[model samples]
Target chain A: MKRTDVTARLLPKLVKASASAEQFAPSNIALCKYWGKRDAELNLPINASLSVSLDYLGTHTRLIPIEGQVDEVWLNGQQLQPGARFSRKVSAFIDLFRRDQTLCFKVETRNNIPTAAGLASSASGFAALTLALNDALALDLPPEALSILARMGSGSACRSLFEGFVEWRMGQREDGLDSHGIPLDASWPGFCIGLVEVDAAEKAVDSRSGMQRTVETAHLYQSWPLQAAADMSKLQQAIQERDFSLLGQTAEQNALSMHATMIASWPPLLYWQPDSVAAMQKVWQLRAQGLELYFTMDAGPNLKLLFQRQDRDVVLQHFPNLETVEPFGSE
Target chain B: MKRTDVTARLLPKLVKASASAEQFAPSNIALCKYWGKRDAELNLPINASLSVSLDYLGTHTRLIPIEGQVDEVWLNGQQLQPGARFSRKVSAFIDLFRRDQTLCFKVETRNNIPTAAGLASSASGFAALTLALNDALALDLPPEALSILARMGSGSACRSLFEGFVEWRMGQREDGLDSHGIPLDASWPGFCIGLVEVDAAEKAVDSRSGMQRTVETAHLYQSWPLQAAADMSKLQQAIQERDFSLLGQTAEQNALSMHATMIASWPPLLYWQPDSVAAMQKVWQLRAQGLELYFTMDAGPNLKLLFQRQDRDVVLQHFPNLETVEPFGSE
Candidate 1:
């Protein structure tokens, strides 16, 4: 089904625009990653995924109805050219909400993390945009509807709608009404994430194209859905039981399995640099020396380390320049 | 069913040793790798594989009857103690040939390539030993019998028995009689292998244990047998048609797929060092700029680059310290 069709079904035919709206959505790191797409058009995943929001590390978007022919998009205080890729994407997503109406938006979005470095700035960007658009148009939709709308911008954006741990259900229906993010009830105050930035340069292959390539060519991808499903269950159990080891191991394995599929793809998508492997070896070495540490990587060279509050100093000692985050603020 | 059973069925019941015998066998690089085994005892593979012999890069072995209670084993210039791992393994393999006969022999072997660094030294080592034993006992065994005997020592040893392109057929029978190497008639004189040694240290995990761990723990391993079969067909076609691109692409992808399965396993069997990834990036960068160079890695960090003689200069220009070898002698 078309993305427009879903948006049209859920949104009102005629709506009054508010003066302005602002919203903030935290970025999330997937414990069970959302990889291959089941429906590329609607951005439906092949398997369910779970993630934890990075609390304060997120995006803040402000939307205002503009009396112009085209949408003006500004990212991190810099106005983007209308022809720019990021501007085009934002305009296209806004078109879904505007529908037949000739309404233009002045969309200004800002991310706290590095943009397009696989830190998932897009997740919070799209999510905050969705929430801001809902408020700007005076469309008082529920959190599920907002999440579904945000997913149209980027697949992982669905999980950014909620705080703490969230699960994105890969629903059975073709229209994808049921596929939305649900925030988990459990919270671990000691859960910490250490961002080891190997390289903040733009990724050579973006996640969308990479995912498409993996789905098309990788033979090992046949087993990914099963792996993701199993990992999702393990992550859910780990979160519920407050099992740090289970969470760290499952997240690391899931991320590695996802990368394995990419590596097995034609042309071989390896996002890791020499330094990336070095950091991984360091994590493995420290873990061997009785430090409770694990790392997960996305479609870029950077590593997001998983650990507890007690090991923060040790992790920082090894990765001296580590950017540590406590998802549930320090007690 | 067992290594001893296969040897007992193939060899003569009683044999007289000649005065002395010497033989050499080439090391081999698998285009389609033999990964998981169906029978660990008999070294029976779960899938058929193909490889090319490394011309002069191999092992030389000499055997002689001795007046001693136990076999004396020597590698290179140093005599190995009987209790050493290498010596025990050599003695165990020699026992297969001796059967119930109470005979002792002096076994000496030497490898041209680095041992236990994913260079497949054991392949040539066992193959040379098998040939030397056949000559010493005057067995006058056919090439198939010789290959089968070498396989009892190491799985890839079967391929090392032949020069040029060879295929090891993973047979169906429980006895594994059909599982042996066959030399292909086709040869490409310009074919070359460039050994880019990232590390010569003994592998952290040997191929045997790595294969077992992948099979038992990696969920993605379920696709490996099919991948091997498909890659084997492509490689055979490439060899038959003398297509360099096809040969290079198939071999590289097959190797990466094997490593992918290893990476997906629990504890993650990553044989790659930081330098290994750097070398791979260099190859990819060179390929992007219209170079026809491709690389394959085994159970260690070293990369064996595959290219034609025409591109040898360009490959060497990028990798200045590359140890170049013409698998099919330069015409």
Candidate 2:
């Protein structure tokens, strides 16, 4: 048995030694694109793409051990299903590395960010999970391996394995050995993201359903890989140079391109709500009035405002209806 | 004066022959792609796309001379302002062509397809006008030139000029001379389209508002040109090859892509009804269950199903909740 496993039986002694693991998993926004997969088993992207991890919004997860239980997981006070779409791959990870031992993982998850608003929920969730699992098991998987595992959960989650901007390198080799997430820089500073949460009450069509339908029916699906690969290269270079206009433009474009692939998929579908449009119109009207706000969207209605920290007040006036508008910065 | 023009002025002499010139304009579906100006002055596309001119779905517009009136215009039976969006565009065309004539354009417009449903109303309206103007003036611009005139009214409208499968070539020359609609195939016989009008309420955001906002704010607006161009090429190839799987997929993707661009646009928005998602989910589930239905969507909640005429029964079973459904074929 591993030393960590034995600590559970000898709980009082383990408490005296006092070990806890906490990690910050920031949200990610795709710049280049990674949509569609060449190898489902390996979770390989049809193309590479770049993404930026934000400083302000994400999940802060801490893992501690309890005395009696064999194995348990408490996510934000809710005992999560190891089978959850977000945490399924993590369960697979735990099963693989800690094969012989059992321990209760007391996870106190604090998600400061909104869930299912299409703002990289998986990225933060998985990033925090990576740190928690890494410390809890005392198993060391290189960042690349961790990313590959994360990719199995959600393709964008892989980007969260690192800080600042990163790229999920769509490896060329067919065997899928080189495919992994690599950090570009932790250098982005003075940037803050303001969110406009359009109160879109409509149910979102699961992306998984859309993606599957698209692959089966969308004639344009094959073209996405090449376009996504090209977009990734363009965005990587732009991010490396800290080109805000280019970064903002590329990220927005990539997101739309990804959504376009969905639109062009067979049975042509959408995830947009009426409120989403109203919010977008309000934003554009504000910009036309010269507020200088740049918008980015994921699959859902809420928008992320990428602007200089100082320009927030001017931008906030435009989105008076947002439920919560807060500052986001990276350490 | 030509015999027709002289006869038109003498209302009693103008029999049904001149009245035949006023066949109600049918609505058209933009097939290839229409976006950003190759020449904003001329309203040319960055790339060519294909659109089908519908027979059943359209608007009924008529012009009648009023005695002692130099000029008068009515839209949808309302004495709308000459500056109303549709009227203004129509007026501009008339002014450019018939500068010397004072004609009353009495338009009694009625939509067979649901209003504010994403099916292209203007595509049909302008298409009808192109034909109507030609008949009214005896200024027979060939189909290609008529398309250029229609292009000025709305980018997507130009595609409706051709019957069956048509492609709008986004000509490369800077003078904007080459962008015009051309038939991809002389016949679109095999395909039958069924429209499922879900929740027949007026759309909150019209395409004009949705598209304009998309252009101004959606970060995805920048990448639209490149993606749309590629889609046009692929769609043309798929149509020419007579591959239903390919055609269905590309069309579906294109429709979704347009919506994505809408969502990515500022004030993040959707024109979808709550029932739109439900209707689509039902279709997807039906398709998954081995139904032969392949569907596409415009901006509205209405769904366009493209399949052989024989597949109507299978498709109809899935849409029990729609407001109305009607099918059309080239025959």
* Per-residue C-alpha lDDT of model 2 across residues B48-156, encoded as one tens digit per residue: 6666667666766565544433334566667767667766766665554454455555554455766545576677677777677667666655777677666666677
Which residue pairs clash within candidate 1? none
- In order of appearance, the predictions have TM-scores of 0.98, 0.61
Best candidate according to DockQ: 1
- Rate residue B180 of model 1 by lDDT: 95
- For model 2 the local lDDT of residue B159 reads 70
For A1-331, candidate 2 gives per-residue lDDT tens digits of 2323322332222222224688887777766766667766555677787766766578887877666534356566787765564455445544444444455556667777765456746677877776676666554557776676566556777888787778888888654556778998556666666666665455666665666776665544555665565567667666568676666665665665566656655455555555554555565566668655666666666777666656666766666544333223433
TM-score of chain B of 1: 0.97
Q: Please give the fraction of native interface contacts (Cα pairs under 8 Å between A and B) kept by each candidate.
A: 0.70, 0.29
Please give, for residues B1-331, the per-residue lDDT of candidate 1 as tens digits: 7788888889888986655899999999999999999999888999999999999989999998898789999999789999999999999999998878877889989888854335868899999999999999889999999998899899999999999999999999787889999999987999999888777333378899999999998889999887888898899899989998899999999999999999999998898888898899889888889999999999989899999998888888888877777888986
Model 2 spans with C-alpha error above 4 angstroms = A1-24, A60-70, A80-89, A100-121, A136-154, A174-177, A198-212, A226-242, A267-269, A320-331, B1-25, B28-254, B257-331
Ten-residue segment with the worst summed lDDT in candidate 2 chain A?
Answer: A9-18
